[model samples]
Target: MNRITTLLILALLVFSCSDSKGNNDTNEKLNALRVELDSLKKSKAEASNASNKQIATFLTFQENNAEEAMNFYVGLFENSRIIDVQRYGKDGPAKEGTIMVATFELNGSKFMCSDSYIKHEWAFTPGVSNMVECKTNDEIEMLFTKLSENGKALMPLDNYGWSTKFAFIEDQFGVSWQLNLK
Candidate 1:
């Protein structure tokens, strides 16, 4: 009976030690899984942010006048400026010193332009135009006059019922604009 009791006591000690080791292993595995889940969440968030990036308007000119047009546009509106300009070298693709690529902003809207080496039969049409909302009548008038200087005014500034004042003009660069007074 004494030997049997000693054997039972040793058995209990061995079982308890194995059970505690198992618990430790389970805890380590759970912690590893939590870290992996956090890493996956961070990766998904970065990919989502990249996919939601902003889109900018692009213009292609064949006459090597992209730089001129970009500069003129940057000067027209408030809070407008040229972000960058990459000019073509003496290569045969485009004229030397011409704008290979140019980035600019007009009234806080981003725009990109480039002088195309290949000439296409199509040019800018008035079908798609940039719409500007003016805060005052004077502002609309000023923009209309300046934008129509060397260009054609498709619709003169006047009340069109739907709007208090509006004008449609094709700028010298052949880009169309619709100026509306708010």
Candidate 2:
């Protein structure tokens, strides 16, 4: 009887020690998971804050003409200029010196552009267009003429009954524009 009691006490001690070790391992795993979850939440919050700060119109050019188009637009608008441009290197997927990304402003409106290395089946459609409100007749006419050059004019500058002067045109870069004289 004495020997049996001793064996039973030893067995209970062994089982209790193993159970305590298992609990410690589970607790360690849970703490690690909680830390990872907290990190992920912080990263998501930072990204959301950055996105909310500013959102600009992004244009993807397939023909490596982003710089040219940006320059043309900057020249047309009154308070427009190129903010920054990053070009690809000689070992690029696109041609060297082609715009990887470019930021510009057109009459206080922000825009972003990039030269695409991949070919896409879809191009710009007329369903969506940039609408410009011109403050003068000359502004509307001049913009229409310049934008219509080497491009198709969807709606020539006319009364259209809605405004004194309004024109819709697709520029050489295939981007559509709607000019209205206010």
Candidate 3:
């Protein structure tokens, strides 16, 4: 009886060895699953990077005299018009010739102008400006130099990441301008 018991113990030890080959198939399957999960993670990261490229950016400005400002701006571009105008007057609102707000388009870009007619001093600052995207270096330089004729230069014409030459200036009438070569 003792001999039989000893032989049984030895057989059990052999079968229960930690380095046995039975787990190899399971390990290979687990490794394959890990590889697949890593591939999926990479694909998701790439997709997120692609989605981050879409950004809609628009510049803003304010003016105390919308009518004359719009008129002066319209003279600079061949194709420009006041798309809409909203006026607030002493009679409450919608008074003719009193422009409270004006929406216009200059060279396919939208611009907004408004008037503060409350007998107070309203002025335009350098904080807001229009960034014009030009086709060539010549165009950029021409616009920058033309706008800088009677104005102060905020940023001198220089090479920037998005253009060959760029400048920001406050025009003669206190309106700001940004010139860039696309």
Clashes of 1: 0
Q: How big is the positional error of residue 171 in model 2, measured in Å on the Cα after superposition?
A: 0.6
Could you tell me every candidate's TM-score relative to the true structure? 0.70, 0.70, 0.51
State residue 141's C-alpha deviation in candidate 3, in Å: 3.2
Query: Could you arrange the candidates by lDDT from highest to lowest?
Result: 2, 1, 3
The models' CA-based lDDT, in order, is: 0.83, 0.85, 0.66
lDDT of each residue in 1-182, candidate 1, tens digit only:
44435545554554455555567665555556556556666767755653564887889998888988898888889989887899889965788888888878788788999999999999999998999999998899999999999999999999999898999999999999999999
Tell me the alpha-carbon RMSD of every candidate: 16.1, 17.0, 19.2
Tell me the lDDT of model 1 at 83.
77
Residue pairs whose backbone atoms clash in candidate 1: none
Error of 2 at 94 (Å): 1.2
Residue runs of model 1 more than 4 Å from their true location after superposition: 1-53
Give the count of colliding residue pairs in each prediction: 0, 0, 0
